[model samples]
Target: MINYRPKVFDEASKSHASKKLYAILLAFIVVMGIILILESIIPAIVSTKPMLEEMNENGYLENPDNFNFQESMKLAMKVSSSPSAMIPTLLSTIFGTVTAIFYCRCIEMRPVRSMGARKEGFFSHYITGIITGIILMSAITLLSVALGVNKIEICHGVNYKVIALYLLGFIVQGMSEEFIFRGYLMTTIGGAGYHTGIAVMISAVAFALAHAANPGFGVVPFINLTLFGVFAALHVVVFDNIWGICAIHSIWNFTQGNFYGISVSGSNNTESVFRTTAVSDKAFLTGGEFGIEGSIFTTLILSIGIASSIYLIYKRQQLQQKKQPSQE
Candidate 1:
């Protein structure tokens, strides 16, 4: 049986403020450096000479002189959206993992596992997270359909290999964000004597800010993203592990982009099983170009998720307290 003593939380909450602050600064510098390096190398690798030649031959560049840097960059981004882009995206997760390790070892003087990477209960929690994510996303899609804000068309002859690649890519994307926000920032801040509530809020806000530059981002999307952050943090607290939240994050994106054939945070995957069309007059419900994640339905579902996490945590605490007397 898993112990519900909050041991990881206690250890993380004991981090020194000065050390945590310094670690945060160092992590920021390292992550930014890594991103800049990868941004330069990955684009060049993905947008090779042959690819450009093919584009020109295919009449994609009818006016070569008109193909400015912006257009070239757009082509690069399009190419990078494919499954072949996995390598570059995976590199991002590596950077995040390295930053977390640096802070845990050098600053907090604790094992990396203390950041909620414990192996116990990982599989079960991860499966639960996957189910939860699918249900939430399905709910949002259904709501949109019912409201006449979106329509879905079935896509045939889907390539399973591409779907597999997207799954892997989304897994990397999801876990990377979780490691940075819930694992590193939340633990470091909470460990530095800040209340758990404060840490969760700070981390959630940071998560939202991190995606502020995405195309088509707006007030509703920003609010919904922040709510997602809060829900993820609460999920970690309830399960006392990061595995579940990682699964949820990964499967959520994969389902949105691959299964439902909808854009995820303003980015669309060319290989999808369904084609979702947004009603022109219902941007608020359909989330328009920003995808279903920006819809009000998302906010409602995530709020319920947050509340559910809180309830589960409370119930677990009570059960643990009851078990204490039995042991005595």
Candidate 2:
């Protein structure tokens, strides 16, 4: 019979101890610190000339006390659309991959492929994820439109090239997140003798916590984000790989911000093919400034997705068992 147990749970014996997992997690934190420092430093250096001129004209530097964190983050994202954004984004993923490798290969004494990063079927899974993401996000958009919760207008003079760059950025962003949360954190926790389902819940909680500080964040978005994590973990367990979830996460955000002109997790995307206008009074339905992901509909959709993924996993196992020879 086909086993429904996750390979990660089965491979727990090969994993490092709890202490080692903590150290590895600390290493990841350090790497993230380095990434944040570089992201800030490089951008500051590039903008030094303008900043200096503005400071001189104003007779003083901008006051830190009056700074708005949300607005600043949005502005930073807008500015990062240029080539410069690639550095931090790429570094984040590369360093994240390095951390995973260090733990899997060095600490755990296992092959990196044991972490479900095998190249076989990578492209196919990624393509499937992209389609899945498109369908989900499009459905959410259509529902909002039908209910008069959102108004979407086509932007005639859209810059396809910029949109392409943003797509690349979101792809990297999504892959990095998947590598950390699904590939690294989930595997580590599950391989530490904990139940794989528990690991999934923990990782999902962490995923939601990471985005807790995002703009327009609310209870609905928090729950939806957690559900997304559970869905992604189940996806990995079913497919035995991470490529598909990475693609889904990437395309989901990209379509929300770049294709549909919605605020992705509350970060405004000024460049898009469509301009989305949310009904001011329908924040519960339209997700307000947090975009559609913060809505009740998103919760329903994600719940369905999670259940479907679980069903598919079991169904696939049944099919595989049916193809085997009888013991008799």
Identify the candidate with maximal lDDT. 1
Candidate 2 structure, TM-score to reference: 0.82
C-alpha lDDT of all candidate models, in order: 0.76, 0.74
Model 2 is weakest, by summed lDDT over 10 consecutive residues, at 82-91
* RMSD of every prediction: 4.2, 3.9
lDDT of 1 by residue, 110-195 (tens): 76776888888888988988998898888888788887888888899998887887787678778878987888777776666666
TM-score of each: 0.84, 0.82
Best by TM-score: 1
What's the C-alpha lDDT at position 96 in model 2? 52
